[model samples]
Each structure stands twice: as structure tokens, then as C-alpha cells.
Target: MKTYVCPACGLVYDEAAGLPEHGIPAGTPWADVPESWRCPECNIGKTDFVPMEL
Candidate 1:
């Protein structure tokens, strides 16, 4: 699974274990995640995140 991290606050987002309570189910790809879904840690948008690994 791919991983993404918020540049502003270093919040990690893993596709293998998505935040279901936040409306993002597990296995949800980063590209599939809605633009409206902000980082729960920093409140930043997905655009602020960058791919970390496969």
C-alpha cells in the first residue's frame, strides 16, 4: 500500500489502513480520497500531502 504525509504537520496517511471514522475506508487509494478530506491532525487538504512509499 502507498503512503502519504502532510507536509505542514507530518501527518501520515496509509492506504492500507484508512481512517474509517473520518469517512475514508481502509484500502482507499490516495487519489480516490476526496479533496474535501482534510488532515485530522493539521486540518490541511490532500494537496498538501506527498507520496512517501509504495
Candidate 2:
């Protein structure tokens, strides 16, 4: 699975290890994650997340 990172705080979102505690389950693709979702570390919106290289 691919990964994404928040540009502002470096919080990562791995598609294979979804944040289940926050309502996202394992295997959830980045495309499925809601746009309203925010980084737990810095509270940055998903719009600011970028695909992580490798």
C-alpha cells in the first residue's frame, strides 16, 4: 500500500495501516479517506497531505 504525509507536520497515513481508532479501517485507500479528516498530530486537513515518495 502507498503512503501519504502531511506537509505541515510530517504525519503519515499508510494505506495498509489505516487509523482505525479514528474511524478509518485497515486497507482503506487514500482515496477513501474523507477530505475532512485531519492530522492527529498537528490538526492539518487532508488537503495538505501529499503522496510520500516510496
Candidate 3:
């Protein structure tokens, strides 16, 4: 699995550790995330996120 980072607020979204707080289950892939989902910290769209390097 991969991880993504919100460029606006530096929030990290890990595919292997899905954001269950926001209703995304564990193991959810980045592409499976909803288009309407926004960064919890910055309130920006998914487009504002970039692939994060491990």
C-alpha cells in the first residue's frame, strides 16, 4: 500500500491504515477514496494531496 500527503496541511493518509475516523476502512486504496472526500485538516479536495514517500 501507499500513502498520500495533504499539501495544504501536511496531513498524511495511509492506505494500509485507512482513516476510520472519517469512515474509510482499513486497507482502502488511494484510488478507492471518494472524490468528495476532503482533507480533515485543511478542508481541501483530494487534488491537493500528493503521493508521499516512505
What Cα-based lDDT does every candidate model obtain?
A: 0.90, 0.92, 0.93
Candidate 2 residues lying further than 4 Å off, grouped into runs, are: none
By lDDT, highest first, what's the ranking? 3, 2, 1
Best by TM-score: 3
lDDT of 1: 0.90
The CA-based lDDT of model 3 is what?
0.93
Structural similarity to truth (TM-score) of each candidate = 0.85, 0.88, 0.94
Kindly provide the TM-score of model 3 when superposed on the true structure, using C-alpha atoms.
0.94
Residues 1-54, model 2: lDDT tens digits: 999998998888999999998899999999999988899989998988999998
Cα lDDT tens digits for candidate 3, 1-54: 999999888999999999999999999999999999999887999978999988
RMSD to the hidden true structure, all candidates:
1.4, 0.9, 0.6
Compose the digit string of candidate 1's lDDT tens values, residues 1-54: 899998999888899999898889999998899988899988998988999964
Output the better candidate (1/2) by lDDT: 2
After superposition, the stretches of candidate 3 with alpha carbons farther than 4 Å from their true spots are: none
Instruction: Name model 1 segments beyond 4 Å from true.
Output: none
Clashing pairs in model 2, backbone N/Cα/C closer than 3 A: none
* Winner on TM-score (1 vs 3): 3
